[model samples]
Target: MIDKNRVFRVLQLAGLVGLLAACGPSFAAESDAAGDEIEVVPVRGGVYMLVGGGVNATLQIGDDGVLLVDTMQEDMAEHLLAAVRKLSDKPIRYVLNTSGNPDQVGGNPVIAAAGSTINAGNVAGAIADSTVGAAVVAHENVLTRMSVQDPPPPFEGWPTSTYFFTPTKDVFFNGEAIQLIYQPDAVTNGDSFVYFRRSDVISAGSIFDFTRYPFIDVDNGGTFAGTLESLNNLIDLTVPEDKQEGGTMVIPARGRLCDESEVVEYRDMLTIIGNYIREMIDEGRSLEQVLEARPTLAYDPRYGADSGSWTTDMFVETVYREFTANGSSEQ
Candidate 1:
């Protein structure tokens, strides 16, 4: 059963935690005006969701150590640590980020190094230590993005490991097969759908946001068709348990845990909206005309219009640009 209080805490993180990527990794989580508690809810198997200050991070605990899919930015790293202590003190072995977004990878430094009690006097040695507590992992494209972000992000919490495998990158730890499957041109060129074979869970970053419409970062190589394709791929990887309700649990970037049914609903909604936007664009309608139509009007109430920062209109605009711009022609 899902805990209501835990769900509320996740919502609190979504509405409160805000991260600034260009500011560097040395920054700390800002103390909340009234302070907030970090909450961890078990999803399936050993996978759990750490919710507090920023985006939802999937936590996998085992005898070997701890593995995280997304890390809330620096703002709530300490709180995240406290929450993790309740689970296990075996140390955080890997910090895997699904994309290059700050909210997703911001806490890499803090969470990854939780096991190391000894502090390094020199920054040089910490960077050189590869076998220790923390090892940040992400797609190679994520490294490329972090390196060219204007002034360039500091090396404090950068990815220590990256994969450029064509279809999947596999890692074996704690007697489970973990695969980092690439989802290119989806939310970003670096998007990855992490599959935990033993746990029967999938950690989908921004590709599956149940709280609102999909966030397509076109400038970062995201496209409409790519987004849908990734969603389809996520569904293909899922397996329902009984009554077609609960089987393969999916941990999204933020929001509630989803099963195969939820993914199908979300996919259908996006397809309908994307088709509507394409029809409008094909008719030579301007962005203004398309926005006026509000293609997602039917889904607004369920997803919530004033739910958070990213709005429904913003999603429509992204779809419009993806088809008409330099993105993939498959759509």
Candidate 2:
């Protein structure tokens, strides 16, 4: 069961947590108001959601140590660490990057540096010093993208462990079975869905933003088809307790906590919009015509934005481009 009181207290300390409106290829800048402090919300089975710093991060705590999924922005590292300290004094043994976006993995250097990794010693009973911090993990594509950035990331921020060509990577950490399920060509080629099996929680990266329209990075292998497929996969992994409510909590890259039903609602919305866009493309409608059609008109009031880094217009245009490009609409 969730600790409602704890969540309420965290919310009080964190103030009004605003929904993330624009998370493009490079996440749009957020005001210092929400970024200045970190709010920790307990999920279940030792899992917690650290809400703030431009992105929501997941933490798994146990006697062994702590496992973190998606460290927020670089500027928020100090506050993030302070928030983590409030939860557990143990070192952060593992850091998982859901995507290569700055908001998702920006705090890699500082957060990792504060952690200590345990290593075996050459001698029979000696334990090696653990000043090396936590082992950062991500998909191989993440490392590739971050490596070639205009101003490369610090060495410490780079993912120390990466997996490629594999559908999933599994790690048993902090008394839970953690699975890093790669989401190919969705939000980005490096996107991952971190599932904590025992805890029944999933750390959905940029693929599922509860706040606004999904940002599909066309340049980085993100596609509308892939996004829909990843959402389907997430739904499959989620199981509801009763009446499609509760059970299998989902922590998105940004926004409040969610469950299987919310994922279904999001999936259905995307599917409906995709179908509308596809029908327009088949009708030989130009991008302008489709934009005028207002396929996402209904959802705009909730998930759409007229002005921001990523607006409803941008979302429609991207989908239109993806569908018409090389006749991908047939797919």
Candidate 3:
């Protein structure tokens, strides 16, 4: 059985823990020193981002236990589990997903099973009591897509609980009202950003990858226009702090933590690149011609398309295809 007093102690000390964590070291320096070790950084309101293990996972720890958004990959389970144990001994009440990508929900089964049983009320942190495992929650589409993969992603990683929203759905956990908002056709049809209301933090999933060009998985129901809409909606939910600097914290699928201003810059990048592609289409430029123009050249240095994966040309081609989907008649 979990200790009630211990839960309260962790909850009460969370603010101080966050303060200490924030002031301790820069994420870059710490991540460089830590090197692939799962590092936890306090965001605010007892919300934290666990980086370096796999895809970024957001942990909300409170009297309710733990509520997680995006559970990295399965291989990192033990590391992530130990990291959660470092925060609280209470059960993990819920695991929410922002994308169906393997890196996002790959650890669902292990982490969910590792969690102790809890009353349904505790799942929401203030409701009523009923027995349950740490629930896996996601948009209905994520469940559908993950179910039909070649090998079919493991069942353990599939979301046990799915919500349908023409726009968004809401859940309560760890004293925070979590909004599982949809961003259809952004990274994929299933993408949803988890907004922790009290914490003012958005676990942006892959819809807002700060690391590289927004991966428009065209084969998976993604569109440049849809991703742009997602980013604009994210900006709407953000509230900057004094001097419009840092207020609402955003934890993307990968890369450094950021605030509204950084999001705006990213949005602008997508907008500019998108408009350039649209104009090229209007000018009747072939995909090869558009690629040669290298519209993303100005931003490539900052976003880094020199290697790894997801090149700038790939992003440009995606945008070109999306904007010209109706252009066969025009050309």
RMSD values for the candidates in order, in angstroms, are: 11.4, 10.3, 13.2
Best-fitting candidate, scored by lDDT: 2
For all candidates, what are the clash counts? 2, 1, 3
lDDT (Cα, 0-100) at 177 in candidate 1 = 88
lDDT of 2 by residue, 216-279 (tens): 8888889888999999999999999987678999998877788887788788778877887887
195-227 in candidate 1: lDDT tens per residue? 999889899999997667877787778777888
Q: Model 1 residue 107 lDDT?
A: 73
The 0-to-1 C-alpha lDDT of every candidate, in the order given, reads 0.74, 0.82, 0.78
lDDT per residue as tens, model 3, 1-331? 8756434533544443344336433223223314447888899988999986546899999876788888888788778888899988877878899988878888888888776445544444454333445778898989998888888876766788788746787887666788999887888989999999988899998988876888888778887778989999999999999976789999988877888877887897777667666766777889998888666765665564856668887888877887787563332
Best by TM-score, which number?
Answer: 2
lDDT of 3 at 181: 90
- Clashing residue pairs in candidate 1 (N, C-alpha, C atoms within 3 angstroms): 29-75, 241-247
Where does candidate 3 have its weakest 10-residue lDDT segment? 24-33
Per-model TM values vs. the true structure: 0.81, 0.87, 0.84
Candidate 3: residue 285 Cα off by (Å): 1.3
Of 2 and 3, which scores higher on TM-score?
A: 2
Report the Cα lDDT for residue 159, model 2.
93
